[model samples]
Target: MNINKKTQTNDEGPEDSNVHGFTSESVVVSNRVPERSTKVASYLDCSVYARACGIETMRQWFDYHRVKEGGKPRPPGIPGDPSHQYREVWKGWPQFLGTNNVASAHLSDTAMSLTDAKAWFIKNEIQTVKQFRVLCTEGLRPPTIPACPEKFYNVKYSELLAPKSGRYLGFHEARNFVHSFEFNDYLEFRAYKRNNPEMFEKIPSSPDRVYMKSSPPEWTSWPDFLGYNRITRTRLEE
Candidate 1:
């Protein structure tokens, strides 16, 4: 068991001697926990380490890390228990809140917070999921932003950043909405969007690619959605 020598000393008050054998210096100072180098030993459910480090209960450690680390790059170790796995380090935090629950306080990579990243999307006019992906594939996205922001942030793309790659009206809803436009065919629908980009800001520019991949249940065919079937039937009758 490697002990942090930095936390070994400190002669202060009565609370100092209350902890099993560790000192206040070994635990927390000014509401700040130790750095990643600090080890939480796996014994008695890490009671010794937890108490020494100002943690009242085992479950409190989750809240501790959430507040301190923004729940990114998990702790170097988790206290051993029946339900929890014991490891020196976790690669990342699991999906929970699916929101920017904490400020980007401990993130070392980019200074941009979740809010900042979202703003960048709007500023760049990245309206659809496909467009965002193409930018990432072409190496046009900034290094400060992740190509898969959902994984990095432990939240779905639409939840963290809306539209994923484009507007996602539910499959049936999208089909109905597109049909209401009275487009003669898929090509005509595409041309309409291209010509009147501002009018369709909330709608995806490429429904065929975007909706087909996303909407598994209600997605039938582009021809059905874009009124191409109706056009084909009319042409055949004529």
Candidate 2:
């Protein structure tokens, strides 16, 4: 059956009420079929199946769990970027949606794998499962949810696009972003710059700080957003 169609289905999950008005049968997921319906897991087994659901889908999860007795405000166990404050990520697995070990071990001790989680939710009547799975699995599409509730304002504009946008991963909207690092990434950035020397003349941003070489802010933005803070691009080829 075409999951994208907005047709009604008798089979739905208990979580359907948490779907925020959308129905699972009407949602469209990725072309890839779910892994296996029987693959089981527990809520704590999240590292393997937590998917980067869309902003709207995340909102639905938040709403669904908030009112439930001993509910969760966010999906548990998925590793979200600290910089982005867990609002969004590159991608996530959905099998761990409501896995709250602390809440109840009976339901959390064993559940479905991320692959089966989508189908399970759909079967259980979670209307947003199909759409949520698509947004997270496809990785390049915008959400179809219209007119979100105002309570969802906590998710930022950048957070909404971060999962789907390569641009957001690299720099802020302004492009000229200054980041200070002291770890392996800092070493990698410096090394990358030394390897591919740009012909573009670079001015020193901070004479005292050797790593703080400066150039046109707009130009710096181009390389930075591309994950090349150390390398600069120019119209002229060296």
Candidate 3:
């Protein structure tokens, strides 16, 4: 059954027309295939003809006739699949349309690996997933970069993209460095931290909070951690 190339302004329906089982009425007719069928016709009115052609959607039926008449198949990502703009048509044909699977298996296989992606992010100064997504939205992301790497790679993107510094020191090592200062209390420790911003970058800002459980056995409290003799100080003050 070939869809007619011309429009039908006459009152004659599909039965009277030379067109096998299709008409331009209520259906978009393209040189190849129409984009989609009109919702004006109820499903019952369109389903029989659609089923007879072995096509599920109105667009499929039109494509079948169009091809039968020697029109080529529409290009990929155009009229073949429902896009974000086709949500209205998608609702009516839930079984055949509106699939949300955007991640392409081919792209996933060919795109940059997670290790390379992290290095690229660091080089480009992209430290957050939100920034990466914004770049993807703006079409600034490279073809090698996966749009949703966490979804594609099954790992947390934030942790993978975290900025790594060579100067970073572990809790115990940083505490050892702080103990060399012999600070009297938290105030003195804060004063030193304020003065030496570069040193604090290597150390945790709040050791009390960061190393609560992980601190070494010598870690009794903030005073002890800072090498402050609180007992001796209290005795001297009294």
The lDDT for every candidate, in the order shown, is: 0.51, 0.30, 0.51
For model 3, the local distance difference test gives 0.51
TM-score of each: 0.32, 0.18, 0.33
Off by over 4 Å in 1: 1-4, 7-62, 65-177, 180-187, 206-216, 230-238
Q: Tell me how many residue pairs clash in candidate 1.
A: 5
Candidate 2 lDDT, 8-100, residue by residue in tens? 365443343333333433332222122233432232222222221222334444443454656433333222322123323312223234333
On TM-score, the stronger of 1 and 2 is 1
Q: Worst 10-residue stretch by lDDT in candidate 2?
A: 207-216
In terms of TM-score, how similar is model 2 to the real structure? 0.18
TM-score winner: 3
| Cα lDDT, model 3, residue 202 | 79
lDDT of 3 by residue, 105-143 (tens): 466677787767766776676767667655654557776
User: lDDT value for candidate 1?
Assistant: 0.51
